[model samples]
Target: MTDLHTHILPFTDDGATDFDDALDMAEMAAENGTEIIAATPHFNIPGIQSRSVSEIKDTFEQMKNKIEKNKIDISFVLGMEIFASPTVGEKLDCGELITLNGTRYPLIEFGFSEKKDFIFSVMDDLISRSYTPILAHPERYDCFISDLQSLYELYQMGVVIQINKGSILGRFGRRVQRTADAILCHRLAAVAASDAHSPITRTPDLSEFVRVLDMNYGDGCSPLLLEENPKRILRNEDVFWESPIPFDYQR
Candidate 1:
């Protein structure tokens, strides 16, 4: 499995505390069947402290070296779960921010209660510039949870709806889990990620994640979400997506 969102790059953000913790997390992910992981730390949130790309990359290299020394059989890629803002485009243009594995597809997130117009605005801005924005954990946001029709519209706009494993399993909350169910039911979510933060809480273990999809959404769904699409993202290839079923909302 290729987990496209994770906070395993230590000392960069609210993820692993140190190199030791990161190694443990990597081992956990590998044992749980995750073969590839993207170290997508949170970046450019309002009023939050941030790290420079060089700093983040230095730590990423350290983690990679440690993984190699320890013989952990997993691959790592550097990225950020960028917070939406007007300056995001400029940052990307100047190389201050990077997409997933340096691909055109950038994994992005927004305020949980942010307005839909703003969500679509940033997404449209990125899309108009020929960048594919992957919305991280849309099920956890009130914007999409309340107006699922708009979520489908995002799908139509060619935005990649990346759902979190926690949301699917109700680890975040009941409301979030319900929203995840709706997204899955309508096939709005094109990709799924661990969004793991540590070895323990919000950990990177994908064992149960594999089981849940196999039991709930069998017949190639598991490989599609956990492997095929993520591999494509890493390779900078066009991802295979399913057409989302529209809601019956009176718009």
Candidate 2:
């Protein structure tokens, strides 16, 4: 399995504290059947100054070296979970941020309480600039939880949906868990990721979610979310999704 989202680069963001912690997270991921991970640190929050692209690359290189030294058999690539803003297109244009595995797919997130229009506007701008924005963990946002139809609209607009594994496991909350399940049940989610922050709280482990998906959704669910779709994104190829059932909001 390839984890497309993670905060594993040390000193880059609120992820790993140091080199050792990053190595520990990688080891955990390798043990749990994850073969590749994108070291996607948070970028461009309101009060937080994110590390520059050069800085992130430097940190990723250091982590790569340590992983090799420790014999952890997982590959790391560079990415950023960019916070959506008006200037995001400009940033991408100027090479201030990066996409997943240097593909045209860039993972982006909206504020938890951001309204649909604001989110859509940012996504539209990104799309206009020829970047396919992958919405990160939409189940955690109140706007989508309040009105899931908005999420479907985004999906129809060609934006990829990625749900966090922790959300499915109820680590975030019951609301997020329900939303994640709804998204999965409807076949709307294009990928699932660890979204792991550290070695402890949000560790890099996809095994439990895979088991749950296989047991509940079917044997085919895990491979589609965990492997096929994510690999397509990494290769900048189009992702073929299952036909989505409508989200039963009354439930």
Candidate 3:
């Protein structure tokens, strides 16, 4: 499996605390069958000092070297979970922010309570700039929960929806799980990731989620969510998913 979103960069953001923690998180991911992980630390978050692009690259490289020394046997991609803002498009255009593995897909997040129209506008701007924005953990957002039709429209507008594993495993509670399930059930999500933050909690373990998906959704869920689609995403290739089933079938 390939985990497209993760915060394993030591001393970066609110993710793994130090070198030891990052190492452990990587091992946990490997043991749980994750073959690839993107080291996406939080960036451009308001009121928080974000690491410079050069520094982010340096830290990512250092972590990779450590993983290689420890022989954990996992691959890494350099990326940033760029927080959504008015200037996000400009920053990305000027190469201040990076995409997953330097591909055209940028992993982006927004305030949970942010207005619906604003989110769409930001996404539209990015798409207009010839970049596809991957909306992170949409199930946890209040605006999306109240307006499923907007999410459908974003999907129609070429936004890639990413659902977090924690939401699927019910770690964020029933409401989040229900919404996550809706995205999955409707075939709206293009990928799933650990969005793992630490080794102790919100760890980068994916096996259990895979089990649940297979048990509940069917055997075919694994290849789509964990393997083929994510792999294609990394390669910047076209992804394949079923046409999302409409919530109201009669509509």
Using all chains and alpha carbons, the TM-scores for the candidates as numbered come to 0.97, 0.97, 0.97
lDDT of each: 0.89, 0.89, 0.90
Residue-by-residue lDDT tens digits, candidate 1, 1-251: 99999999999889999999999999999998999999999999999889888998898998899999999999989899999998787789789999998899999999999999999999998998888899999988887878899999988898998998899888988999988988888887778989999998999998887788778877577799889998988898888888678988732
The reply for model 3, stretches above 4 Å from the true place, is 248-251
All predictions: root-mean-square deviation over Cα? 1.2, 1.3, 1.7
Q: State candidate 1's TM-score.
A: 0.97
Candidate 2: tens digits of C-alpha lDDT, residues 181-216: 889888899899999999999999888989998897
Q: How well does model 1 score by local distance difference test? A: 0.89
Per-residue CA lDDT of model 3 for 47-68, tens digit only, reads: 9988799998998899999999
**TM-score of candidate 2 versus the correct structure, residues matched by position:** 0.97
